[model samples]
Target: MALHVSLIDFLSVIPRLYPNDPDYFCSLCLLSTSSLCPECQHTHSTHSCPIGGLCDTHRFHIHCLFNLYVMLNMP
Candidate 1:
């Protein structure tokens, strides 16, 4: 069977179910942030994606810089 539990619904019941376990938590939700859950489709910023935080936009920039550095060094 498959279970679909929204982050919002799951977080709500956690406090009640485990009242004494205040510190208990899921890292996925904490590590991954959305506007408020489902409202914004979980994209934090313009360059961010729903799954990967910062959609590798910076990696390409770094690659370009490296290429430029190599080109400038070559005789």
Candidate 2:
């Protein structure tokens, strides 16, 4: 069985998965936050994606991942 998640839900859960890691930064935008970017200037809320396989050392903005997904899926 596979878990299916919407981008919003996936982003929402990323921060919660690493609640105590203050030094955690997004590998893409390189921003650190316990729950979303404090200085995010985008109209929509930002989320995070863990890179390097479930480790806090690497992460990327959810939007970045979404864009990458779109590009990769483009035909």
Candidate 3:
């Protein structure tokens, strides 16, 4: 049987961080080289959901998370 999931439930599977954590790397960009680079800092500071982390083994920026969510829900 096929399994169906709601957007809220699907999104809940992704991990998120609040107050900003310096140790967590971006899931989209696994490399620590740009975890908190200047660009990321600017995005985080300017964006609503500034901080985000991997749910399991994937790290990503807050914006990336939103994009992922949209992509997954796209038709």
Candidate 2's C-alpha lDDT?
Answer: 0.45
How displaced is residue 15 in candidate 3, in Å? 4.1
Ranked by lDDT, top first:
3, 2, 1
lDDT of each: 0.34, 0.45, 0.50
How many steric clashes between backbone atoms does each model show?
Answer: 0, 1, 4
Query: RMSD to native for every prediction?
Result: 18.2, 9.0, 6.4
Q: Which candidate leads in lDDT?
A: 3
- Which is superior by lDDT, 1 or 2? 2
Off by over 4 Å in 2: 20-56, 61-75
**lDDT digits (tens) for residues 1-75 of candidate 3:** 223557677567654442145555444555534435222444434455465555333335666666666766666
TM-score of 1: 0.26
**Root-mean-square deviation of Cα positions for candidate 1 versus the true structure, in angstroms:** 18.2
Return the TM-score for each candidate structure.
Answer: 0.26, 0.31, 0.42
